[model samples]
Target: MLLKRAIGVAAGAAVVTAILVAPASGAGQADLDSAVREAMLAERGAAASADFGTPVLAEPLVEPTRSNDQGWAFGTTTIPAPDVEHAGPHTAIFVAHRQAQGWQVELDGTAEFVEAVERAPADVVSEGEKQLFARNYENSRVAVADTGLGLPWAEGVAWWMGGGPHGDSGQSRPFSSLDFNGGNGQVLSAGAGRVYKSCLRNGSGLVRVVHENGFSTTYYHMTGLTDLGDGQPVAYGDYLGRIDVGLPCGGSTTGPHVHFSLLRGDSHTKVDGQTIGGWTFREGAQAYGGYAERNGTQVGTGGRITNHGQGTSTPTGVVESGQNTSVNVRSEPRLSAPVVDELPDGSVVRIKCTARGDFVDGVWGRTDLWNQRDVGGWISDGFLYTGSDGPIAPAC
Candidate 1:
């Protein structure tokens, strides 16, 4: 289900003047601007503090545009860092939708809002087109590896079957539900990645992690949670939370069990067509009936698996101090690969893949500085430490 959180608008006659005035199908630039300003004011007032004064929107919102197919508009705004709670400049994307009365604040956040906007087209367009676009994007960005996944629970923990291989029935998608023998069990991340969402609300508690390889794994029906926040990096075998069977955590579950689902992409909209370790995930399939093998060895099954090799070809590494204080990120994987950007000491980067390059100190590691625009190149493995021994990440 799409989680909708209502934005609180301050009640006042002056505030009413800022209400959005737009057509039924689309919002004009003036309406969008008014909506953005009003939403920012409300958000700032809600986050105000005496020590920090009042948070004000930085002038000149970025990427102010209306939705192509809906009565919605969005803009990215910058909030200057203050002296109190929020100490750094923060960026937010605000969304406003038209209503019978006027335009109102709908949603605001970072990538999540971006995703919501992307999915809005599906509401007006054909579902087939949406699925096709999703598949195309997945094929372009994702390359599944043959690494086995670690079973989410600890060893010797016997879990009963709560649900298995369900089809797309309402809110439930393709997933397996493992019921804890004692009404609860420890839930662990299926692989190493960043915690995308740790949302617990509306009778549902879940954790979604985006793996280095562009795939995402979700664990739902959790009760106790770890201290991991959104966008926090997590290592393989990290404990996420505990499973619970009842309401407020496990949404509409009959028993206490963790619902696990491997996805093809980071967004929830791209959950279909998931393929892990070369096995295509199917709806209504048995959780334990399927099997995956690596080099003729039975490594994982549909139900239980290890996080051994279930990641993308890209490996995450940190920029260590080389002969220089910073490393030059190039457009390609060689010394002559045209420097695109520079990475300071202790900077974390994702190595898209290794390439046989101009050997420097017996190292030939290459990476694409994905986070930085116009930055990508190869760095010597001598300066890039992947925390893992040998090259477990796939070759480019």
Candidate 2:
């Protein structure tokens, strides 16, 4: 099954509903609800303009989760689309900030909310609070390796890999998402992390987990979500919600299955050749064309792969040159090799393969392993941040 991207439109109106969950003591639920309504109305108007056909909004399944002394509120609301016969209501995730004028609301996943926190006045938000929020935002952007993620289901359960490694934005490049079905339709967290709900209608929507190790995961078209407030912590294998044909964010699903996606920072990272749940995923020549290999067994697309549990590190790294402008990329693994280019610090790179070569004491320490870049040439793995002291990619 292919998953679609959500359309974002913003306009203005007014609608208020009762708080589905209790807010923090002293927080003004009415004011928050009113602000959210305004944002929703604007979104609906935008949707209408985009030919969504008089978009209909439902009361939030629960009160928007609040933090920083109620200075911030985030939650989901449903947009029922009667015109779309095969799809369910499209859900929207929103973030609202309390300003001197009023509550300012915007769609989540954008930088506006985070930037607002960064630019918040000291009088309105304390220094410590600002730092806390800033750290959270940074965590979402930084990429980490060896996140130790597994299948998005319970252990020992056999699930059909209906769609192999594919792009999160439909059938596109960077095959980073997988579709799975079976095991009671229950979707579980692949690892432990903070949970945030986005795109909700009635009660079904998408769930994202920002893993402690810096990687994140998103589960879309899910139903029966728990009453999880934003930023709630969840353990690995925790039941998040159920997979169904709920198109809370305007996606079409042939049947009930969770579109499990692996994310590094805000964008989806390719899962090809990455080992998860004891099976290594190999991307297909085309979208949704790949196989998961475990032991001597190779399960192709549309086949069932058992959740063997646990994950293996993938061949990826970030460039790091302490106190230097860029790290040198050579035609060969040796430092004496001709310099082909310079990789700027903090730049993420794909490790095509690796080979043992001339050792050098680099920022991460001395290593003989040299990483072959996807583009061409080689660089010291020590200078590459692969979250491992040794090599991670295949041998050259």
Taking the candidates one at a time, how many backbone clashes does each contain? 14, 4
Which candidate number would show the highest TM-score if scored against the true structure? 2
Tens digit per residue, CA lDDT, model 2, 1-396:
111123343464334332222334444767777656655554433443233333353443334644456476556554444434222333345555665555666543336544654554554434553454445456656554434678998754568999898765455446778989985888998987667776666677778776755466888778899676666678888989998877765647789888888865434578986778767788888878889875445788888775645554334566788888799999998889999999998676766788999988899888899999878989897777654466556788
Model 1, residue 301: what's the lDDT?
27
Question: What TM-score does model 1 achieve against the real structure?
Answer: 0.37
lDDT tens digits, residue span 1-396, model 1 = 233232454664223233344444444666666655555555443442221244343432334433544565544443333323212222344455566655665333233344554655543323442343344344436453342344455422223334334421122333322222231377777666556332234444456665544445666557667776444568766888877652332124555666665544322222223434222333334433333332233322223322222433333556666567887776766677687677777665665555556655523244431222113565566665443334434566
lDDT of each: 0.45, 0.66
Q: How many residue pairs clash in model 1?
A: 14
Report the Cα lDDT for residue 62, model 1.
32
- Lowest lDDT sum, 10 consecutive residues, model 2, at 1-10
Which whole-number lDDT from 0 to 100 does residue 143 have in model 2?
52
Top lDDT prediction, candidate number: 2
For candidate 2, the per-residue lDDT at 236 reads 88
